[model samples]
Target: MSLCYCNSQKSFKDCCEPYIKGLKNAPTAEALMRSRYSAYATHQADYLVATTHLSQRALYPKEDILLWATSNQWQKLEVLKSTPTTVEFKAYYLDQNKIPQIHHEFSTFVQEEGIWYYVDGEYR
Candidate 1:
């Protein structure tokens, strides 16, 4: 599908493909957030955990996430505001059951060495 971010110039496959496939690293929190959204859309659980903070990595279940992704369709992403280690955005999508949903949240992230990691998020 076409993406609203990146000026709608690229499909999720072309724009965030590397990061979603665990072939490329996300250098920033916002970039990781974007790639994670793409991963969810594509059901790439391995990529999700790979980009997450090591401390919190255990909180996620790869299989469960894969199942959840199968039932959802990611539609759009909006990074309303962001800093080097944080981001506030709205992610829009539709559940497989066809329910539309919007996750508006302020997400916190941290960088260790040179890798960015998702810390937590609060709904807004």
Candidate 2:
């Protein structure tokens, strides 16, 4: 079994695949964050777009999201903290030039109609 891209130590199928495949919704903000990281690693731009909060969707065009996803070689995800509606994490990746980079953020989430959507993030 392939390990989840989110570094959750679970199989991809058991962790993020269901979320990415539209078969299930992430039950919590942290889950959503993990699955979103997995989406980037897998280059599933549509999933990324669909999981963003509606109000912020326009700011994240699918083509741009896809380009960002495909341009990086996602390496790891580190979940530093989580609350009901927030997650702080670091995403490690390699750029197209093969240079290592880290994207650190404290992300906010909101649950609407029992579904969680990523709102925005404060970059660190």
Candidate 3:
């Protein structure tokens, strides 16, 4: 079975694909963060953009995101702390130069009409 990009110990199809495919909405900020990490791994740039809060979408134009996502080899994701509308996490990956890297961030989320959206993140 292909494990999820978030390393959630579940198959990709059983984990993030549904969110990426628009089959369901992420239930919380942490869940949205996990699915977004998976979207990067799978090169689903559109899903990444679509899930972002509209006010924040300008920061992640699809072309730029596609370029970034395709350039890295995403390794795994760890959820450090999660609240009702925020999540702190670490995403591990290898850059194009093959250097190991970790993106640690405290992210905020907003939910509207029962759909969660990524708002912004602060690097740590």
Please identify which of the two predictions, 1 or 2, would achieve the higher TM-score against the true structure: 2
Q: What is the lDDT of residue 79 in candidate 1?
A: 81
lDDT at position 86, candidate 2: 96
Tens-digit lDDT string for candidate 1 (3-95)? 524233576666788676666677778888887777777777888777777888778778777887777777777789988888898888787
Instruction: Quote the lDDT for 80 in model 2.
Output: 99
Clash count list over all predictions: 1, 0, 0
1-124, model 3: which lDDT tens digit per residue?
A: 8999887899999999999999999887888889999999999999999999999999889999999999999988989988999999999999999999999999999999999999999999
The per-residue C-alpha lDDT of model 2 at residue 49 equals 97
Query: How much lDDT does each candidate structure score?
Result: 0.77, 0.98, 0.93
Q: Clash pairs of candidate 3?
A: none
Off by over 4 Å in 1: 1-8, 11-14
Query: Which candidate wins on lDDT?
Result: 2
Which pairs clash in the backbone of model 2?
A: none
lDDT of 2 by residue, 58-97 (tens): 9999999999999999999999999999999999999999
Give the CA lDDT, 0 to 100, for residue 28 in model 2: 98
